[model samples]
Target: MGKLSNCLSMIQILMARPKVKIDDLAAELGVKPRMIRVYRDELEKAGIYIESVRGVNGGYSLDRRSILPIRNFNSTEVQELQIAIKSYLSKQPDHDSTLDNALEKIKAAQRDQALSSKHFYFANDYLINAEVGNESEHYKRLYHAFNHRKKVMITYEAASTNAVTKRTIHPYAFVVYDENIYCVAYCEQKEALRTFKIIRIHDVVLVDQSFYLPENFDIRKQFPHLGFIREPQEVELIIDTPFSNQVKESIYSTDQIIEELPDNAIRFKATLNGEQSIKKWILGMGTKARVIAPEHLKKEIQLEVEQMLQNFQK
Candidate 1:
């Protein structure tokens, strides 16, 4: 394996099983114990804290508080991180040689501090297939506008009718759920908050106008209850066993209530803003879940499933 790869593997191993002896590391790396010391020194130079305990119970372990969070990444996450880093680097202009040089140094430091075998155990299978076109450009512009608290003028193609219309919006933030990116913005034309899919934006232009974010505007708090476009609404769902745990853990955080039923089923209740997102989530669970309360929502989900079945038959 390459030096950088080896280093990353070593770091992962140490993080997973701290207090591992030098001899064991050498055995795992297929090198002499002396060489393990060299790798340890390299890690220390790169700002990793490798505490060595001596005597009969002597071994090396990471000082958990001092070690960076990257040490905990699974192999897939590491590969994704590498791709993101490369993508960012590739976007830098050709004239930015100094920045490129600095990036190389940073990469080297990261490689030296990481566990070498971490990259060897598994093949990276997660591929991020982001569509690169006008939609991608719109996403970038929207992200910038949201970050800078600026308004944006966009030509959006409505999903329901596919009609194109121009509108001005105060871009608030973005939510990347499932495989799509959504922009949460205050639409001046609609006089209400709206969520626009980045894919449906035909054109986007950052406007000079800026807007003030409300003091009560907490993205996480509002997102779960009201979603990007919808007003907050109370919704209850009945989930069957095995799937109940998955549903509860995935959808509701610690704040939400989860009640266990005698039938080994689980009931989840939450005040969500956008029913659409949660509805889609329940449908994804298949027959394992059913919406009990709010007669309208239950009917909506049933209708959606029937429509899906019809589309499939075609």
Candidate 2:
């Protein structure tokens, strides 16, 4: 039998007997231990649970629940599966409907309950510009670095002055905000966690050097104040009447403290980083937003508006 056929047969055998030794299986199938590992990965992708056990008598097992028999698929179930797969594929830049059709046929043939249960759904409201140029390549490299726990060298563009410089970093995760992709990595140069915009990356090179992630490290918990902008700063504002509610929901801030006023107005406070991002956001709100604290920010906004008016008048 071919490798694919052999792998399928191995899954069937493992399903019949939940607990089976890797060595015993390899001997029985006349395949090497390396091939067994490969087949195990393929089985996992197919939604089968193959877990390794440790100790003297420990081996591999098709997790009890995952060994359940395939469920019959009705027309509705098949259509739902097809729709779910197509929806997921649509999110990718290069995927097409044909792949979705093929997956649907495969699901129909297998009638796998796990596949049926593993449906895809997503919701997106903002418009994202398709990334271009070396940026895409940089993103791919960073993604691989994160997946493989490897270090990388990246030429990055700073948002403040658009200055480009090279730095070595340990990629932790990729974050998407304001329709832009960012690499949240541990910067070796800075000795701190920093977020790099993919669009700003001029080039990337993966290095063989690898590092282990700290056990207590949780990206989401560490960057609670992060939004579209990755910088760290705090700002409080008291928005005048008629604009407070809109500002409360639309503005991206860490902690939004809203206080109702006597004259139908509201006060909002939020911690923000990335002054440029906040400035742009304030400009987007036009007159609806008012800067309560930090006199410099208000002045900056005034100057920007004046410049904008000058352009329009000309």
lDDT of 1 by residue, 1-314 (tens): 76667677788998899589989988998888898788888887866778899988989898664476544553333433443443343333232345445544444444432332211111111111245222366766876676577999999999889999999998765554433456777899999888787788898988998887664564554455434344555678788876675544443333467898867788888765445556756776679888877788899999999999999999
Stretches of model 2 off by over 4 angstroms after superposition = 1-135, 151-153, 156-169, 174-200, 207-211, 220-234, 238-243, 246-255, 261-265
Query: Against the true structure, candidate 1 has what lDDT?
Result: 0.64
Task: Provide the clash count, candidate 2.
Answer: 2
Report how far residue 258 has shifted in candidate 1, in Å: 1.5
Q: Please give, for residues 1-314, the per-residue lDDT of candidate 2 as tens digits.
A: 67898777887877788678888889978998888898888877766668899888788877644443433454334533444443443244134336645754555455343422321111111223245212366766776676678999999889899888999998765554444556777899999888788888888998999977665655555445434435455666666655555544443444667888767667777776556656765665567678876778889989999999999999
